[model samples]
Target: MTDTSSAGWGLRGTAGVSFAATLEFDAVEVKLGGRVVLDHFSLTLKPGEIVCLLGESGSGKSTALRVAAGIQPVHGGAVRINGTAVSAPGLNTPPDRRGIGLMFQDFALFPHLTVLQNVLFGLRRLGREAALGQARAALRRVGLGDREEDYPHMLSGGQQQRLALARSVAPRPGVLLLDEPFSSLDARLRETVREETLAVLRETHVTSLIVTHDPEEAMVLGDRVALLRHGRIAQIGTAAEIYRQPIDLSAARFFSPLSEIESVVTNGHAPTPLGLVATPGLADGTAVTIAIRPAGGARMAILGPGTPGRIVGKRDAIGIDICEVSVEGLDLPLGLRQPSDAGLSVGQDVFVTLNREHVLVFARD
Candidate 1:
């Protein structure tokens, strides 16, 4: 076993490297099986930044990653790395030829090879001694130095993921692409491994792009998130900006569960059972839908002066109390999430207060 603490395998200085490396997709378009997968997709990743490509399945998230890796050909536009075009009209760079590393959803480690051998596989171009040294350092960097002789099956899922990451970064590629890398792990282990992986990527200072369908995962991992819809960017911004001010209803619902109420703008205000909500910049008599998040706005209390409501149902979730409250003047029961000790019960009278900040008024779709 090597002394992992003293190895300093984390990416240090660029040293001799002069220019910063970047990844760019300029008006990229792709088609597969005669169906358009991506259209006019454009994104840019500055050096050392982690950008998450987030969307539902078939939204072209993985297709964009493949294009960046040079595995998928673009029908139109270009893919560039460090100002050099890798994918364009008739020119295409092979996956291995482009200096980019990729880690698939499945760790893809060979069952027959030892951990050291797997890391060495990426560094085969170096001499025997140099490759051996790099492989050992990479293993130590991932806290798996003692397991160099172990095969893939002998390690836990988290260890295997770290091994895969070590192999990908062993070549010191300027850009790293991860396609749902933590999807295979269980929930608890996924979070731990994700943190570890992010720390390593930051230390390496490699511009990284991750593809995931989970909005929470994107919020946790991305410095900026690019939310795709129908092969196009629906919204792109920091997690705070995306969640606080979604461009539309589709973009808002992507980040959190919402309860919608229909209303018509009257004197620049929409009336709801809770109260009058401001709908500025809207013409009088304009129809609109107001969206509110239970966890963000709702509060429960014993029956009192607040909006009159009767608790029709109650459920105790993992860490919160979910109550279905039927308010006067509302046809549907509004879901409210409060503290577990809320003491709410079915058929009990209660007061529901809506936090004005959580209310979002949008034009009806």
Candidate 2:
């Protein structure tokens, strides 16, 4: 029986154990060109759940996926699929036998092969009709029911990606690995195709691992997002948990844009130009970084008189305006959302107030 335990994101029931079994990587380490790509990396991807490996370029996100997919040999570590040992030190399982499907960033579709042929490529061992039936069904699941005969160049970018997804899931592998699969598509198309791809994965109950550097993408698609830093697993948690309670300053700033202000605890609250409300238990003179979200800070007009900032500048940020406030004694930039009142301007004095409860405090390390 498949496990269906609720764990992260408040996602329960069938959505919980979407993957049939956990893909386990124990103490994995990989080196490339004499540089450590991954060091003592480890994580468990539960069944029916999409786990996103999130990081920037060369942060070892893709390398982890390759290691789990049985493509890259590990320098030292163990990889297991459904609790079955596949690789460790010297014993490496061939990619074909690993029961893994890799969705490349470029889709990796054969230019010369038709959509049907590409999907049926893995189904070749079966009879022609049987292979075509499965391929057609997979294509249909991805909403590309009528594009079977189309060549790679003939399909739109979105359609081509859908075809690639169909081909990957055609074999119904135990685990599906996506390496920045949506990176190449245009934004609108990317969202549409990603939604479609996710829906199909849900319907088919395909256990998937997606690797991407984009945080928002990770939040949208993952059952849990694991942040990798300098070749190690930094933090693995639900989107809510990671966003709400990041482990350290690095992890905190990584997922969300946060401005850290050095503050000293006075009485119960930290004394700042904005005014201290209440933050108890902090030792006196203890230095701490107060994490302020870009969207949550208040403008001087909103905070009445006695505020401590001067309007530095303002910029249009897509939908909302982002106003920068300059505060004395704080080297960090204070970010505030544009207020309705147009009273503040460059060099205009204003007071900024932080909602103390929502503010996160991290001891300076």
Candidate 3:
């Protein structure tokens, strides 16, 4: 791991700027093959903050990055960097002149160029000595100082990612956009490289927008997460806010697997197989769906007492045991994450206790 504390690759020409460097998307729209991809989408990224655009496939995560990078034309609204409109009606700036850095998922390093040459590729406008200095500092910041002479093929997957990152930040662009840069790495290598990339971003203090489909990756790297669904932003907030207080059932299920139960609101509460859950601001007799996450504040115990449920399925998931319990009168089985020592079997009986704080209630359609 590289030490980011002494890394001096700061933003260029921002010495006396009063306002923070910002990236704003105002009511941006996009269409592909006569199908709407992004509709009236808007976002604002403050200086030195990392925001992750998170969603499943076809949710417009990549389109948002392209629009910000000025490679994709917007059908409506505008894209502003540092309050200057670079993308708007009848006005579009070329990608290379936008003062933005982008790293594609494939790394896109020049196969014929050495690591130092690739890093210096973005610094072409600077003098030879200055570009060399900046490239060396960028490589050192990413812990690839010793591999400057090696070609991309000679480096490991993680090192290649670092090299790509070094190249992107070498010019000290105001905003960095990464489109699923870590998606190609294996699980273990992804974790290591992701951490290194985040460290470099933090030390450099460059505003960034990273696009990813993995919920865990979004939560780990983003200061705030923008959850997209069907060409619109479903929710935007910190990871805890989005996970704990999702706007709807779909948003809640996107972050974690949920067991849903049907109920009707009565006297500000609803009765379930677990217990009565408070339903404030909802009228009586209103149909509601109760969603619970097995790993979210819920406790499971043996059939010694409480609501009895028959275990219908069981599986060992590496460090823990996941069991599905079928309760009487419930249409779907409740999933539980249990300790391995519980000695649970498929035919055994168990009891489930719901943590009201972890339960999410939404009006049933």
Instruction: Give the C-alpha miss distance for residue 71 in model 3, angstroms.
Output: 0.5
* Estimated TM-score for each candidate: 0.91, 0.87, 0.92
**How many clashing pairs in candidate 3?**
0
Using lDDT as the measure, what is the rank order of every candidate, best first? 3, 1, 2
Candidate ordering by TM-score (highest first)? 3, 1, 2
Worst 10 residues of 1 by lDDT: 10-19
Tell me how far the alpha carbon of residue 247 in candidate 1 is from the true structure, in angstroms, after superposition: 0.9
Weakest 10 consecutive residues, lDDT, candidate 2? 7-16
**Tens-digit lDDT string for candidate 1 (71-100):** 898999999998899998887999888888
Clashing residue pairs, backbone N/CA/C < 3 A, model 3: none
Which model, 2 or 3, shows the larger lDDT? 3
2 versus 3: better TM-score goes to: 3
lDDT of each: 0.85, 0.78, 0.85
